[model samples]
Target chain A: MSTEHPEEGRVVRFPTGGVSGEVDIGQLFDAHAAYLVRVCIRLTGSRAAAEDIVQEVFVTAHRRRGDLIPDSNLRTWLYRVAVNLVRHHHRSSGRFNRFVDRYKVDPREAPAGPDVDVERVERAHLVRDCVAELSEKQREVFVLYELEGISGQEISEVLGIKLNTVWSRLRLARKAFRVEWQRRHGEGDHP
Target chain B: MSGPRRLMDDPDFRWETDCDLGDEAILHEGLELGALKERVLAAIEAPPVPPEPTSTASTLGASGAAVKGALGVGLAVVAALGVGYMLGAAQPLSSEGVAEPEAVIEQVVSVPDARLPVAAPRVPAVSAPEAHSTEVVEPVASPQPLHRAPAAVEGGASEPVRPAAAAEVAAVVMPVQSEAPGTAEAPVGESGTVVAEVAAPGGVDAVDGSRLDVEMEVYDTAVQAMASGDYAGAVPAFRSYLRQFPGGHLSTEAELSLLECLFEAGSFAEAEAQASRLLQAPGFGGRERELSLVRAESLILLDRCSEALAIVDALGERDSRTAAVRRECKRRR
Candidate 1:
């Protein structure tokens, strides 16, 4: 009964094959892929993993376009999918996921340039590394709340946790980040 | 307080204490997301077989062995069979009316998040010239076959296309016999027809598992379907879950999820009714705001802009997203 191909521009072939209908996922990709990549890179602490998660998010979105709330915020839906993917990636990796989170440094941070001020670069690296060091749950809560500009309630919905839990984790994550920042750059100075 | 902004209202406090934890400037420090956009986009255009890439880090951690090992086979088999079955089954049913339309509600998240939305069984609506609709397709079928192809049915697949989950699929594969009331022993009859069917008129298909609380599995599948963007699959599945366990702990969650599924499925009329019911329900605790948002959306879509505006106005402090939707609805009005 449905006939509108709003995404007539980009056709996403179902993994199961046969020339099916086209979704505007390509437009979604154009609009938000990079934003998602930033969120993924921040959450996972590694570019490779971030890239992997971004791909999975899109593919999942493509797979579940029907469930998408029409005329709703597509960005919110996409963010929810990305958050779930990151959590799943973590859950499946089990301990390895933790290990990757604990020791892994993001590949995106650049080495200090000859002309660049070394102090700011070190401080930034220290800050970034400290961010990567927060426990997975805390890190996730922190990034969504602070970095992604998502609210605690929405974070709760997307992450499927209690609002109190999100607040608690965020509170702890802030303390941990503070401590780590101080530990790295001894006293008074802050980014 | 406003939802997202209330958390860190003071910019100075965040900058002084949190110290740019979520700074966008940091995102592009040593990276160029623009360069990889084309490659990433290309990959999305034609993604590989494995939905999640198994990373080297997975093998290193003490906790991941069981999880990684379990997910690889679990997701592959579940996705292959559960999704594949629905995909092949959804097509003909669209024109054929082989399955109940409301059955599709999202279930569990695949990534242990268990975000449930059945990868709903949907046939892409074939277009006739006059009426135009943007009915999204749920790619329920996987390219690979984890199990034998479902028995052929009229129009196409012979099996009644009920969106099922990996766990439910496994339960159906391994049936347990018990007199327990909720036991979903695959409705066996004179012909040995094992296709997953809703034995009752109200869309309640009990699982073939031995557990007394098979509702969880049903609930899980519905959530999965909902999560999979198969709102068509999610609606009925959520409906069934609500029916099977009206007083069950997850009932409230199921109701809200059903609202979302109906709204997303573009069943504005049903969504409006469901949202009204939810508004009247007794124990709607923390879910009123979310439900109100759904009600607003449904009203807007039904061309009841005034009613929708009233709902949004009552919220007073509307979230940015909802506020935008309100503005659009008014413009249309």
Candidate 2:
């Protein structure tokens, strides 16, 4: 919702009284804000809502920058914050619940038809639908691994789940997606 | 669709599928800012707001949890009593039983003395503390801070505080007619008092004839406890405030605060009961919006969606915060 110019994101002044090593929030915003917005859109399924949440994450990050682990991955940190913020947003606003309900999204891929672009769009919707069907935990695995390009190890670090737990959840998410994708596409009846 | 038939056999087709989903493209376009690029450029120039202070222990693992819990319990008790002590007592504002506005100003009235006279040290319904914690509630050898109490906590006193002192503080408290907690405010002269203070609903009591030292004391106790994440402690403190000032000026604030404390304490049944009672009280004014917000939240927690929605509809205004609560209410409905 902020109409802040892209140029503004290029620079940031440190908040007074902040501890040392705080990230310049303006530069951080310029670097990660758009990527975060896109990630949230994928996570939350609403542009207006996603933009608002990303904005919150940036503001919160700006405040807590001093607490940032010096050697930690900033992108990973942002993902962790974005994930938590989106979860809180869902729990508090119930917007994601409504988003899922309105679209009747599930874990199955949409059926690919004869048309190419239509199939491509439906495929995109289908992937999201399938991702949605995974439980919150499983969805975290799939989103990080499949969409955000985060590795299983990084997900373990971000979610604080063990490496094996991440892989196991990812494994289950894949299985669930396979069954649903096959079923929806009418490919499971036979070869 | 045409190229993926055999690719599905690979089981690794998801990599291609992810790319084909336009996720990567969107990620690129997202970074480009596109039309929002202009918006971002404008927004980046704005100054940032101060960051919120986050609780560290809640995020940290269970390493020091036991110690934190012990310390929190100790602080909760101390805060409760410290706040109650601040309530202290008020003096007779008039000889004719008609309190004068200037004479009985709530803010300026000092505690008779920091040492509250206790006939018998009593036990609280809350958990029992060790000797040191108990001293906070009793008359002691040296004075201690009432946990940064600026208003109700007037001057200082030397000696250990006693729990009994807090419970029986009413003994030394001014006789403002405890007969009607719901109608406790007897008009203190028409001129510069009651009307002026009543209009400032949520501000500190004026040094010019306000009726909320006792209520404020208990309210502060609960508030401090809540701030420390001790809703259980806050619950009793808020209830104590309401009991001491049922019809008091800040009663509406106390009532709403009590509902919130109860809700946060996870005593949904009690919260619901109190919410229903507060809604019916004729004196519950100016707090309708907040009270309704609490009522709706309570009902939603109780799984009574239809009831919650009705309360939401009854709300007078809508903003982002209310909208969030309302969305949850509607979703639950």
Which number leads on TM-score? 2
Candidate 2 per-residue lDDT over residues A1-191, each given as its tens digit: 12243443343333322332333455566667876887777776655456655665555454344444544566766676666555544443442133224434434323343543554555666666666666767777776777676767777766667888887887787777766666555563334
- lDDT top scorer: 1
Docking class of 1: incorrect
Candidate 1 residue lDDT tens string, B1-333: 344353235687656654544333444556665545665556445523332112112211321222223233343233323221211121110101111111111211321212211221211111112222221122222222233233432111111122223332221111222233433323221223221233321222333222223444565556556555566676766665555444332454556566656655667889888777766666442235545666666676677878888887875432233443465465565
lDDT, candidate 2, at B53: 18
**DockQ of candidate 1 relative to the true structure:** 0.07
> Residue B210 in candidate 1 has what lDDT?
20
TM, every model: 0.40, 0.42
Report the C-alpha displacement of residue B293, candidate 2, in angstroms.
Answer: 6.6
Chain B structural similarity (TM-score) per candidate: 0.40, 0.37
lDDT of 1 at B331: 56
Residue-pair clashes per candidate, as listed? 59, 29
**Candidate 2 regions off by >4 Å?**
A1-26, A95-116, A188-191, B1-333
Interface RMSD, in order shown: 13.7, 17.8
Q: Report the C-alpha lDDT of model 1 over A140-181, residue by residue, as the tens digit.
A: 888888777877777776676788899889889978987887
